[model samples]
Target: MDPASSIVTPASVPDPRATETVADLADQLRQLRLAAHRPAPTDNPLTLRQLAVLTGLPHSTLGNAESGRVLPRVEVVYRIAQACGVPDDQLPWWTAARNRVAGRRRRAPHPAPPPPPRERRAEPVPDQPILADDLLLELGGTAVDKAAELLAGRAPESVVAFLQRLHPALVAKLLATMDPVLATGHLSGLSPQHAVACLDATDPGTAARLLTLTPVTAAVAHLTAMNPEAAARALAVMPGTALAARLPHLDVDLVRRTARTMPVEQRTALLTGAPLPPAVTGELLFSLGFDGSLALLRAAGARVAARLLTALPADPAAGLLAELPARDAAAMLKQMPAEQAAARLLGMTDRQAAERLAPLSPRPLGDVLAHLPVPCAARVLAWFADARRRAVLQRMRPERAMPIRWHTETATYRLWLPTLATEAATSGATSAPTLAELATAGPPPPALTPGTGGPAATG
Candidate 1:
């Protein structure tokens, strides 16, 4: 061949296969556009501007897609196909061809295979001198001491996490060496069982401080697990509200034991300040017995005593009142507002109300009784000895006392009439006292004089 003929020009060479070049994708797009129906009523295919409108793509972008200097993104290729009326099923094929050309153009050269991992001979561990037992102990203790020193200043959350992995005895030692507030914070994050174990190893005062900082339910669990004496000491130092909230949930015997461990004044302060449940209050008071309970109530003062009495169930409240010296019971009642005292008494049996109220001087007694309804007042008064009842009624205003006195006498008569009839029948006597005679028999209650300080009379 001649030299010129042998030098083939680039333009004279054939193009690469359609699947391998971006121009193939561009040509495909052009063919799709020519075959697509025109948007306007004219004998022409859709123009790039019309196609851009249909595709919501820029006109220049559409022209560039057809120029084929760079491959359009697969998404752009798919959108143009859709605008050019490519069938839904055929749309993916057009994108696949675009992606194939893109894959060839952007393909990275294959990396050389990684060299086989080199194997090396294992090195022997250096020989260590065997440590004596005592030396090992000293080293271990030093390590623990260092850890505790460092951990003491760390955040509670991290300290707690670290402690959770240690033995309980060691945890307790670390906690005990830290500042109390920091230790308490860490203790609070521990599980109840773990916290209890740690607390058991610490001094009661420190244990108490930790428990007070802990959540109530968890603290209670710890208290329950601790020795009663220690728990009581802890409780004694805790805030009144915290003590109050947790005390009632503990065992009665344990609580009683706790009370015994505290100083009398401290016990009174804690119990009085705590709003213990009625049943728990009753149980604790009963466990203390009359003398201890009386001493505590006296120290707590009459107002607190009245509140405690009023919160108790009727049987226990009445029992406690009856157990008190009459003077003290009367004093407690006087400390309460008349209406409140009356309401408290009304909740008790009439006999209980009368017994508890009997020692109050006539004025205060009449004040409290005045808040009772006439019939209720009468029922309560009928339980009083005749003379005391008369004195109380005499201290009231006539309008208030008369109706109550009448009801009192009537109820008393009705109560006695059956016994009188029984006696008469047994004796074979023909006559029993008539209702009128019986009603008249007791000396009429002395007429009442108005008294200041008596409660406003309820009709």
Candidate 2:
């Protein structure tokens, strides 16, 4: 008490922030451990066997730590982390508390220091990176055959980009997930825009890294050709952009099939078609992370961009089109069969779009088009190439196209303006219908309440 008191002063007393009694802490920890499927001494709250299965660590290891016989080893600590969904970094705090209660004082372990810089051994030559063939062995795929599938397919530009980026092993692993037809479809879709050197000819390690970012179709090819060591290395360090550039070249069909498998930023990057720098491409995709892809397409700010994106494959294409402004939406809407555009417009958050759309009837269309969502939507509409839109609008039947309006909320009806125009314009009399005639059809389409989705509407 005298020695302890000498070190303690009233103002500077060390408050043992370790406030919980060691025994209490240990008991609490044990309960948590049990609930985490890493029960101390193997008594799990859920079930002993279940706990053991969850941790993947031997029960004896955990048991030895709890009975105060031995401190748990790093192995058990990691197992606990997995079972409890705790991060590895939190181990020190948990273990510190555990030991304090047990009254076990031991020096903290330190990692072995790196060998003195000069003493490092030199790496040898003939260290050709391992091939894709070897890596595929681990996943039970045939590298050569897999490679053949890629080469045979009509891959897209994007698919080629993926092939250029991934390591042999990773490619093999990814290919293991595809069937011959799917692989062929993916390859067929690809355009292979990236230079073969940035991709196919790179060392295996880089290839592996790139492939991590690449789509399944592209990576499979060169990866199948890689040696094991090189493949592994490539899988470790390749950039995603390298993978992205390869994809745009792929066929639309394959991209649609494989897009869900890759991250959104990568998908967007591919869709951007901006000729991004490798660094920028990787950065763009990486920065977006996962959720950025879910964001609106208008977020990109360029109408030309949103317009260009319209040409992408369905899944990714639709996602891009989603962020467009109203007029742009309308422009796009007018291009499609009324049903399709209306369906797409249905996904928007523009609360007043319903009212604006009320004038799908040319008689009412101007006012509706006036309040349409903006410079944003207008920018998109500017890109409409309406001559093109009008051509498509001319193909439908009168009954399907006139007086495009939604009268009943009770029933969800999509009044496609284009359908009406198509039907009216193509109705074909010596004299074409006037704009006024088209706007106020004397009688609408049977379902559209006269004037809509009918031949007279376009007249």
Candidate 3:
């Protein structure tokens, strides 16, 4: 194929300032070559390949120069122009393209030279068995505490395996010699059982002091893995006042999980006594089954239960209320702040709200309803029999009664009454319930059982 015939000059002119920039210089050079190579009606123009052959340079050199990817040397430009039969009169254009590219390079910013590479310090892992003290000093490098930090960052299993090869007494002595805070980090990396074993072998005072120094997470992990009797003995000897203060400050979730295996009284003491935020306590309780959480909620006393309830969404709160004895449910509701309880109940189904609120005294129940969205409060009143509805209405203030009645009467006309106060109340009170709360209203989808497509087929 003849490349020269296929080359169509683009209609758009190159930017006038293109030659001022290196990038534009290259582009301008390409356009110049194409312009120079355009054929006259009487003569066949040379293609880039033919010109390359005549100039004793690769075709790519001409193509790259024409495409502006790379600027050609002045001599190469002169040679391409001469091969293409560019007249001597037009030779200065080729020189100008080459000079523009070179000039741009001189004006462009120059990057700073890179810095030389630094020499690295050697870290050699010993192949042969070494004495405990020597290995400790070598790994630690003049600081026993820093050694603990370094070793703690290694894989937990690897650290434990490395320590197991040493004499037990020597391990105890090494741990005892280091700052307790630093030793806590190294001990935390070990399996809880192994950590417990190591601590048990140390001097009782030393072991207790070290345990106190450990973070609650590491201490709980180790203690939980120990046999109950062994754990109790260790706890009995620890400096009780300091350990007790520290335990309360430890991670609440960790303390909650560890408390499960402890004696009932001890577990209760740990969880109830820990300074856990009410929100965390509610989330933890919600993780348990309906029965377990109910039991804990009951035991938490009215004030704490009220605090926890405010953190839960409507459905789970309703589910909890459904499970509790009427007396306990009423007590929890009475203890709850009127505004929060009303907000939560507004999201509940009419029946759930009715059943729970039916037990409450008139004054408290009226206060709760007054705080609820008009639609939800009206819905609850509608759920009651005529006698109960009038009783509740009679007890409510005129301000509360008027809104509830207005919402109930305007229920079907809500869309037409955008300016009505009840419409705003309905829209403002629509809190989206969580998936867990929604799940409580219906059974979960069945889990996929092994060796079955779904439920077993009936014969």
Candidate 4:
């Protein structure tokens, strides 16, 4: 009989029930591979490398499947059988053999019962291990107080080492009695929980200093675990940048309480770069009251002041802008994009927009006005008084300024011309209002006809 034919007998077919061990399964897989007919120069029917290409499994994995020491997963067995050209009808037989071996191994008893479960022990109290008989005797059992007294005179390293071993509450008391600077050094070495306890027992300023030295994430955790009022007090003493960095991670209510306790300068700092949500920032500004909020904006410098103002409600923002000194308000507006400045101005009454923007130099004012809709720009300009309006228009490049000037003329005509015409016709007056009289007339109408501007409207 041909060698391949001999390998393909009924005895060589993998029988799932007979494959009780991984070695039996591996032998069946090898016989399957050997019995497969494939083009090969050597006696082997298929090389492992060729099988790898056909199956898309690594050669090493293919070798391991037939190594007998380990049972290949059923999927691997199926893939290898398919690559070997096992008849599709027989693929399940190979897979079943692998599963039978796997199931048998799972059911096999352990060589020995699991070592009996070890007994669990109670956690010892914090200072028990470190408290010596002599030390206990020296303090008459007032360990925390006596420990503080003894550690006070020691070197910082010694204090840190001694405190690290005690209970957090005991460490907290010991730290309270030490000089703050020395205590902070020891606190830095303690775990976060212990550090928090010490900070809670200490004054805010000292707590703030220690926190500044701690990593930002760890410092935030310590603050979150501290009493809210105590945390707020600690935050009050931190530098603005450090405080800003920490506040976003703290709970919002805690931050609100912190804001209430912060000085104006620190609050300004907090608002400047802290990544707080807009609503929280609005609430913080509101808690400052109008005057305090104004002071914060003024002190926050132009750029930040502009940002904070934009976040306020329209009415509050307009009121704040109205309250700012003309130069300061103009400077804040200049810091904003022209479109943003125009929108802010548009939200205000004409007189309010005029007052806030009047102090801006002609060039910037024109730039801002350019962004306003023609009718809105013309109305705001009407409140600027004639000379200021003319100066702002002249400062704009001609092409840009022409549209506004024409719209301004058209708006003026629309507002006063009809009334003047009626008055003339009714009273038998001989002429219409002069250009100067029309230009100087009461504020331009709030809005003009949307499409009503051209040489004809200008006339």
Per-residue lDDT of candidate 4, residues 365-454 (tens digit): 999888766656665676666799899999976655666676666645467434534543464233432222233344443333355432
The best candidate by TM-score is: 4
Model 3: per-residue Cα lDDT over 32-70, one tens digit each:
445543456555555667667767879887777776567
Candidate with more favorable, higher TM-score: 1 or 2: 1
| Model 4 vs. true fold: TM | 0.50
User: Candidates 1 and 3: which is better by TM-score?
Assistant: 1
lDDT of 2 at 360: 48
In model 3, state the lDDT of residue 166.
Answer: 57
Model 1 per-residue lDDT at 438? 35
Candidate 3 minimal-lDDT segment of 10 residues? 439-448
- lDDT of every predicted structure (CA atoms): 0.64, 0.39, 0.57, 0.67
- Scored by lDDT, model 3 comes in at 0.57
Decreasing lDDT order of the candidates:
4, 1, 3, 2
Per-residue C-alpha lDDT of model 1 across residues 1-459, encoded as one tens digit per residue: 111122222333222234557787787777666666543457576678877877788989889888988788655776676666554334445555665565555443476665556854464442222233423343364656576665543333445666666677878777777655456656766787787777777676777666765556767888998767767777766666667778888887777776666565665665587568765676556656678877777767788898787766654555566556667878899987887677666545454566678778888999988887666676566656678878888898767787666665565546753453455346423343321123334434434446743334445
Instruction: Give residue 240's lDDT in candidate 2 (0 to 100).
Output: 53
Per-candidate TM vs. native?
Answer: 0.48, 0.26, 0.40, 0.50
Candidate topping lDDT: 4
Please list the residue runs of candidate 3 whose C-alpha ends up more than 4 Å from where it truly belongs after superposition: 1-209, 213-265, 271-275, 283-288, 311-315, 385-387, 394-397, 410-459
Candidate 3, residue 174: the lDDT equals: 62
Mind giving the per-residue lDDT tens digits that candidate 2 earns over 1-459?
111111212233212225234445434435545444222445324443454666776767656545554555434533453355443233334433443333323222365776888997774542222344443343354465565443332212334345445554454444444443233233333344332233454444434444543445546554444443444345334355455444444343333334444455555655465554333333334345434643434454445343433333333334334444445544444444433343333333222233224324442233323332222122112223445323322443333222222121113222432343454455323343322222333232233435334323233
Please give the distance, in angstroms, between residue 449's alpha carbon in candidate 4 and its true position after superposition: 20
